[model samples]
Target: MNDSLIFATEGFGLNLNLFETNILNLAVVVFGLYKFLPNFLGSMLERRRSAILQDLKDAEDRLEDAAISLNQAKKDLASAEQKAGKIRNDCKERAEAIRLESEKRTVEEMARIKQGAASDLNLEAARVSGQLRREAARLAIEKALSSLSNSLDDKAQDKFLRQSIKNIGDI
Candidate 1:
């Protein structure tokens, strides 16, 4: 039975029964491939083309967005730099103004102090002069009285006393 099953009725290539059936199967396969392969492969290729185009479009859009973002960042950086420069200039101007104001105030304060000192000095000089004048007058009066008492005799004293009495009566 195994031998019967394994044995071919006719030789390998020249058999009439199996050759016709194989030829029919080959024709059917060729016909099916010729009929279906173009449509299948065309649809598959179209789908792949669409996917690739979509990916390219997406990449282009992303690139455009990145360019726009980069431009915006550059603009922001420029604006920030301008603001920083303005701030630095403003700070420098403010510092200069403050320094000038401080110098002006310092000069004014020094003038005021000098004026006060000058006024004080004048007041002290006047006070000292007045005190010296009073001292000089007192000393002159005492010296005159001492000289007169020492130089006058008893007769001159009596005559001077009579002259003083006459002057007092006239007053």
Candidate 2:
């Protein structure tokens, strides 16, 4: 076994100089990458963090603005509801006033009509009374004239006519 190990070593001997050169090259590349890549990667990571923070701040500002708008809208809606209630109350009051005015006018008109009717009735009664009195006087005169013509004799009628003519001449 020792002879075979010596034969394998002779076939594949260690090249220390080549190994040292490859190790030195690898160290240089690792050191170079460490010196420059970290700065570039750190700057990129910092920019990404700043961008994310800026986006978060913008989102927060937008949320605040939305909240403010929502509060304003609520206040506006409350004012609108109050205004609507006031308007409704005003309309009811105006309607009531109109109804009262109409009722008052109607009552006044009814009273005036009643008064006019009473006046017309009184005037009609007075006219009818005057006509009745005139008719009664005419009927009384005709009745007296008929009774006197039937009761009086021709001699008495002549005497009455002569006396009436003498009395008329004297007047």
Candidate 3:
């Protein structure tokens, strides 16, 4: 009436049983691990791989966006630099033009001043020359009259007076 349902090998377990050694339990556990472990581990690995691939894809997209933004920023910076350079050149040209114009005006004003001074000098010289000529003529006329008074005899003076009077009457 004490029958324990344990199967035993005939030669190896002549006195031992499956319930004592737990060989049946060990076999079932080993068989279960062999049959199901690969599926469980493979599914877990596949999920992890998919998540890693998705993460890599997202990272790549973000990197591409960043690259585009960096390129646009570079272009904007270059455009701003070009505009700044153009403005600088325009300002330099304007400054040069203003300087040249100022120099030209100054030269023109100086030339006008020199010409005015020359004209005034010429007028003064002409006035002085005319005055000298009048003075010289007066002196010569006085010397001639003095000499004529000394050399003129009465007969000659009378003849000279008659001829001069006739010339005046004809004119």
Candidate 4:
């Protein structure tokens, strides 16, 4: 009985020592984790937060640039539309001028053709009138000759002939 009691007391002491060792090891691990984990996690979180802020700033800058470019593009489009309108107006004016010029040229050409035709008609009329006058003169001469042949007789002719000979000797 006495030996069994000694053995039981030794076992109880060993259990107590093991419990103390385990408690000390748990405390050391807890202390080490408490000291190191905060710094590591804080640094990593700070880096991630900085990267997020930078990305946000970059997005803002890009948005501003896009807005500026959009405004410029709108201005350019408006200017181009004005230029196109001016060009269209110029072309219309030029076309109108050309049309007017063509009309004037056509009128002038018609006038010239009319004048030339009038001149040719006048010349033809003059030629026809001259031919008619010549025909009338030839008929009158033939009528006069026939009338003279009928009027004069043989006796009258001899008397008139003696009178012309006296007149010619006086001249």
Cα RMSD of predicted structure 3:
8.1
| Global fold similarity of model 3 (TM-score) | 0.47
lDDT of 4: 0.85
Better of 1 and 2 by TM-score: 2
Error of 4 at 75 (Å): 1.1
* lDDT (tens digit, per residue) of candidate 3 on 20-120: 76988999999999999889988999999999999999999999999999999999999999999999999999999999999999999999999999999
Looking at model 4, residue 89 earns an lDDT score of 100
For model 4, how does the per-residue alpha-carbon lDDT over 20-132 read when each residue is reduced to its tens digit?
45978888889988999889999999999999999999999999999999999999999999999999999999999999999999999999999999999999999999999
Query: What lDDT tens digits, residue by residue, belong to model 2 across residues 29-102?
Result: 89989999999999999999999999999999999999999999999999999999999999999999999999
User: Which predicted model would earn the best TM-score?
Assistant: 2
RMSD of each: 6.6, 6.6, 8.1, 8.9
TM-score against truth, every candidate = 0.63, 0.65, 0.47, 0.62
Candidates 2 and 4: which is better by lDDT? 2
Models ranked on TM-score: 2, 1, 4, 3
Q: Candidate 1 lDDT, tens digit per residue, 1-171?
A: 223233455553334454545978888899999999989999999999999999999999999999999999999999999999999999999999999999999999999999999999999999999999999998997897678789998898789889989999999
User: In model 3, where do residues sit more than 4 Å from their true spots?
Assistant: 1-74, 153-171
- The predicted structure with the larger lDDT, 1 or 4, is 1
